[model samples]
Target: MNSLLKCRYCGWVGGKSDFEWDHMDPKIKTESFLLDFLQGKLELICSGCNRQKSDKTSQDYTFWRWLFPRQANFGPIRAHTFMDTLLQRIHREIR
Candidate 1:
């Protein structure tokens, strides 16, 4: 499956040799690794991007996108959705 996949986070297009499978929600932080894997929360990313993203949750990436605006593939529409989700999560926590 060489070059058949693209990095979802960094948009890197390359062969399988350069790609790495990263768990978007991070298996280490989640309750069950098997559950996370079975839930389809994994993504293919380039080695460099995998290192840079490094177990950061989607919320973390959302914040990083706000600060850097050039780190990954968080576009405007996606950013709006992400921020909305983030706000909802925060509101729930505060309540």
Candidate 2:
């Protein structure tokens, strides 16, 4: 088990287990509503992010919506193009 894991969103360092596995990947390129199952994860995130997502809070919800724009199908969806777009955005930021 990893004693120290850094969050990709906020970069908070802690035990890997402390982070909750986040469903849905932000980096999917295709429309989630079109697919039946997700191609990404259940990544370990901090409680703060988890709570925000669970509650669908304004800030967190918007953040997630921007990161992963889905049609609210209530299930997994194939995510490839979404990831590509997300990666492009990230790359643009670094450049």
Candidate 3:
């Protein structure tokens, strides 16, 4: 059996087909930056979460939901960890 993958944002577990690529930061549009981002900065999230996060950086999306209690769906701790790990990886890659 194939190993299941979890969506970093929503924690949904499923086969690879159930996930899609998302950029950790969506504002950098340079070709070289995109290539670098594709190497490791891409996030794997479920379609629903991806659609909800469209055009927004992970930080913005998380913060917006956090600022408004009614729109929050996932746990804050999990989202914080995800952001922390992602930022660490990005920093390491840049150094």
Better of 1 and 3 by TM-score: 3
User: Which candidate, 2 or 3, would have the higher TM-score against the true structure?
Assistant: 3
**Residues 1-95, candidate 2, lDDT per residue (tens digit)?**
44787655555677754466555444443455435144443456665556556644335555765687552112222246568899999999999
For model 1, how does the per-residue alpha-carbon lDDT over 2-93 read when each residue is reduced to its tens digit?
Answer: 34566665566666766766787774546766676777877666776667677787568657756886655421123457689999999999
Rank order (by lDDT, best first): 3, 1, 2
Candidate 2 global CA lDDT score = 0.54
Best by TM-score: 3
The residue ranges of model 3 lying beyond 4 angstroms of the native Cα positions read 32-34, 37-39, 68-95
lDDT of 3 at 79: 48
| lDDT for each residue of candidate 3 in 5-86, tens digit (9 for 90 to 100) | 8877667787776677788777864467568566776777776677778898998987876787566444222445769999
Report the error of model 2 at residue 2, Å.
Answer: 4.9
Q: Which model scores highest in lDDT? A: 3
C-alpha local distance difference test of each model: 0.66, 0.54, 0.72
Error of 1 at 17 (Å): 1.2
Per-candidate TM-scores read 0.53, 0.39, 0.60
Residue 33 of model 2: what lDDT? 40
